[model samples]
Target: MTDAPLPVRRALISVSDKTGIVPFATFLAGLGVELVSTGGTARALREAGLAVRDVAELSGFPEILDGRVKTLVPQVHGGLLARRDDPHHMAALSAHGIGPIDLLAVNLYPFEATVAEGRGFDDCVENIDIGGPALIRAAAKNHDFVAVLTAPAHLAEVRQALMQHGGTTLALRRRLAAEAYARTAAYDAAIARWFSSANEVAFPPRVAFAGSLVQTLRYGENPHQAAAFYRTDGRAGVATAEQVQGKELSYNNIADTDAAYECVSEFDAPAIVIVKHANPCGVAVAGTLAEAWDAALRCDPVSAFGGIVAANRALDEAAAEKIAAIFTEVVIAPDATAAARAVFARKKNLRLLLAGALPDPAQPGLAYRSVSGGFLAQTRDAGRVDAASLRVVTKRAPTEAELADLVFAFRVAKHVKSNAIVYAKNRATVGIGAGQMSRVDSARIAAWKSAEAAKAAGLAEPLAKGSVVASDAFFPFADGLISAAEAGATAVIQPGGSMRDAEVITAADERGLAMVFTSMRHFRH
Candidate 1:
């Protein structure tokens, strides 16, 4: 019996990234392990002065069909699938003169990157490496005996273990195997999604995307319910869905945070949005985050209680201090300064999230909605509205400043629930009403919220009637317009696709309200 454990005597390595290949191959050679590679990997190892066997030589077949046929033959897979304990497996390997592969290092081609570059379908299809995925899956499935490395970052850990133990441990093999399977799964999902887009038809029979839960919240929309946060693989938004500080996220906390983030993401300037009950109670843009917070807070001081606040700019000491004065449930920003972090330390129950920026709106993905018996699927509403697209249907056209605020309000309203009405003045929401069965009721709720905030803030009066109003969708009747006008709204904006558009426009005109039709519906259902 030798003191050394069973070493990785035979290894097959293929990779798109060649980083650390020379040193890794040299280390393997020193261990008396036979290195087998294909194409560029073989050339690289050979140039590094290591004796590497080509896959063709081991398989006894040439790579045919423009390199697509490499590493798919029985000899390549047979070496990986053979069992060390079973006599039949051993006999089959011996009869075929094939050596068992103890280690496989493979990474798939850059299919996502290639497609992202606006490559044609043919280019994307060619970039899909079939052999690489097969090798990875085979090695991962037989991980009890074989070590499979899919990510280059794992090279150091795997190499150290191999050097120390003279063989990969079962634990390391299993961990690497999990990563290998994950890599292949994500790769195939990307391919399916791409094919679906290219062919204009659903791929994989039914479209499904996978996301791992980053955290389980304390509760759902209510404390009695349950909720969890999931981070989609390869998604760049929301700081990878992390909780940097404060208490555990509640069900309502996550929903409000999402609402706040969506509102703040609409503006390019320094902005702040305060959300309560999945609706924006206050939203504002200013020269600095502190100023924006002050303006947003001024929108609805009372309703801002226990609300979620999100800012586009870094949270500074001044802004954090202002936010701390109120009873806020959460505060999120791209980053928080050291002084800002210090302020939050006092508010132990306030959840702090630092998501750097918004996600790109054009990315393709699925949107899910749960129903009574099943779930519904549709594409995300990533559409945007431009100010120039607005048509002033009223006699009095909206001014430039009003137009800007209208656009801002429209975008914020899009994220609010149905029958949504957002009251914005100077890029700040003075009031918001959402989730009401009647559009007029939503408007009244928003107005009432603004009035309550004004009283709490000791302002002589709330925002004047000239403040803009944004509706998530078209108003079915003029009642909503009349309610907004009575509440001091001077300009209104909404998607003009409703059958009663003329009636709503007539109501706005009767009140001397400047109304614009965006021709874009933003119904959040």
Candidate 2:
């Protein structure tokens, strides 16, 4: 409440992440604050030439139970939780041979990291700290008298506050206490979420999800809204993707990059996917990265400008050369060859991200979206189309080549927005229309965009000619089916559950187009 600082008499320091611990302990020791630490922390401090009282010595009991029961004793918690303002609390602390612990710096065990490394369940369980959370909560609860530090990242500010105000300020203590609570809460939540997921329980009676704040962005989708990026503690994905070059990624860049990456991951072959505004502008799979990039670019070279590009394989010089000529915002791949790296180096403002490997799109996980009232959480869209589930809905059956292209477009359609239409030939997207409200309009737009893109590239023939078409959902009316046929689509694929499916299939038959219906529908919004 007051702006006054709280003087430190004694501090407890234990950390799994020892970053900047020695300097911090030395600074506190210089301030004449008695340092009490447990096990490894005590040994670390002693080795650093700083005198530290072992928790065993202070508690008058040796650490037992594999060094886990050292700091859970009443001697430590009583010192941290006692109220200095209350006479009874002070008398109780004194009667129990407990000295006041004015500060607590503790970092919990790396359970999240252990789990991420594919460690066995027993290893992960052992890494979850019990006493650490207890100490953090006790000191944080008594913030009026005790200052707490939960992470090594906060050591600098804590030490600075001590130097600036002769000790930690009440405001700083309150802030650190809030942070400490957050750390423990998120730590527990991560463990719980992991358990729930591993146990195959999608939703437990009580569920909590947590992420560590990675960075504060310049703004949200727009400049008017503030935003921050958070990532799972140790799991690596697009959220934790490292930018190897270029300017710091913007909010839109991150979103588009993720879209591109996820789309590219749908392919097993060497593939390239270009994304703009979170929609796949182009997608292609080929024998070589260079060929894939070229075919993907041919889908819509104009839209590929300033787009995010993702590839499933390591980028090669051949692919990098083609990309170097284009103005792209980001390139994401598993890795890059030396030649590729050299080629990309010329484009300093182009961000290159090495994701190590593509995240499995089929991996079961939760996806969240915020709504005005609250939020909507659902399992990720990992739908797949197989020949077993494919039905020939029209009179004309698709050829082997047509079926392959139809399947390719169908996979790409899954990444497109609602009312999506994708046209592909030779496992490469030729044109795409996404996010349209009307299904017929999407079909028409796909053809028109194909023509426009062809003209931009100085080609007289539109790329959609004789291409296979895929719709994310079934056509409600014959108009949508007729539109795709009119665009020179030789084959059509969609989930056929519409009331007017008969009319739509009849239209496809009239146009001499091979039509296949997939039982599963993928409607991305």
Candidate 3:
């Protein structure tokens, strides 16, 4: 085969992540590809003794405006955007001392990391590089003639292609261009989201967001449909969801996973939350994961079957063995031990997810719901109901232990579909009522489930008529309180923003029930 003409003569390299940069740049240099770098990258390359030219030198202008105007000039962009097939473009570039830039290795500044550190808004805004994004976009838009590299992860592949072909291939250029565009898109989305959230502005009229698929599920809700999970920048939330191991997540699996993750993320201690069909079947906190799993299992054994379980701590061997005895659909935790992995080996079909630390609760994200016309958008419910924000409205106040369970029940109930009610004796949920048309019906379902669980566990009384109850929303009428009171809920916790809050308080008082007002409503549709 005859030698192919080199497509890439000049290259501009700028990056925030410097991993493998030296080796990649060295390889490009050996191929006689001119290297132009900016700021820290230029310093690092020169210190490594590689023949490197500063971006300012190639652009024929000093980096003005505090280094923000380095690569935005025509000298840099003309090289990247010039069409190799056009003689006029080549003539213009030759006259202007601009050579066709075949390879553009560039990554933007760490805007996301700066914002995540809780830095001032001005600091984050300053970290957004203008010239970096411009160069990336220019190179990506002209992928037919230019190669773009955005991620350090692609360094090895690009090096191999360059070494094997004596230059990067057109196919590789196209692939890297796609990735470069995706990187800038996601970066822009993050900036938009951060600004909107900080300013409390509604979604922009023209909002564009992008994320990568984390995994494809076995099916969506049912075996016939399709589904997948996507994560953005490996952050928290449903979009940032990660599946450590399992058969495949379904539509219902994703829904339940969201519910399970939300509930468990609220607790700071070692806790277990068991979710079935987007409702918490059981939840518990203890000194150890094993104890937490046992207490949660004892809450509603029957409902826990094939349910999604989420824990706040690492899964231990004892907890894994206990969980293996039941037919669980999924089990998630921060981490798992080797012994725990061995125990779970017995239940090969059960999904095991190792989610690291939960995402920051304050970060904002869009909540999407499918509607008849198109879709409805709203802000995700990232609010937390803390004990300090609650008030005891009833004549009696809940004891400390009861208060702990009450708080746990409230958090669990928030993720359950409305009309929702949750019952808990210890930290574990005994029964849950969800997606009912009537609050009274939800209360009844929760009470009955708890009773059944108690009986199966051979306890004389499951809830023992003193278990706490949590309502996701305010009691619109006193009848719901009456229902929970009759169902043996000794204490009730709910958001007290309703107009008829006095009536609900009266009903609780009449039934000798302790009621606390959270001043916040958690309505999951």
Best by TM-score: 2
Per-residue lDDT of model 2, residues 1-525, tens digit only: 456888888999999999999999998899899999988888899999999999889989998999768898999999999998889999998898999999999999998889878899889889989999999999999999889999887899988887888877888888999999998999999899889978999868786778788788899899999988788643335776777888888889888998999889888999999999999999999999899999999989888999999999889999999988999999999889989999999999999998887878788778888899867888999899966679998889999999999889999999999889999999999989999999889999999989988888888789898899999998999998788788889999999999999998888888899999998899997
Task: Give the per-residue lDDT of model 1 (tens digit) for 239-340.
Answer: 354567888877777767877886687788898888888877788898988899888888877778889998887889999999999888888887899999
Give me the candidate number with maximum lDDT: 2
Kindly indicate the candidate among 2 and 3 with the higher lDDT: 2
Better of 1 and 2 by TM-score: 2
Model 3 lDDT per residue over 306-360, tens place: 8988877778998898888889888877778999988887777887877776655
- Sort the candidates on lDDT, descending order: 2, 1, 3
Pairs with backbone N, CA or C atoms under 3 Å apart (clashes), candidate 2: none
**How well does candidate 2 match the true structure, expressed as C-alpha RMSD?**
2.3
C-alpha-based local distance difference test score of model 3 = 0.82
Candidate 2 structure, TM-score to reference: 0.93
TM-score for candidate 1, residues paired by index? 0.82
lDDT of each: 0.83, 0.89, 0.82
Order the candidates by TM-score, highest first — what do you get?
A: 2, 3, 1
TM-score of each: 0.82, 0.93, 0.86
Quote the RMSD, in angstroms, for model 3: 3.7
For model 2, state the Cα shift of residue 340 in Å.
Answer: 2.7
Residue 274 lDDT in candidate 1: 88
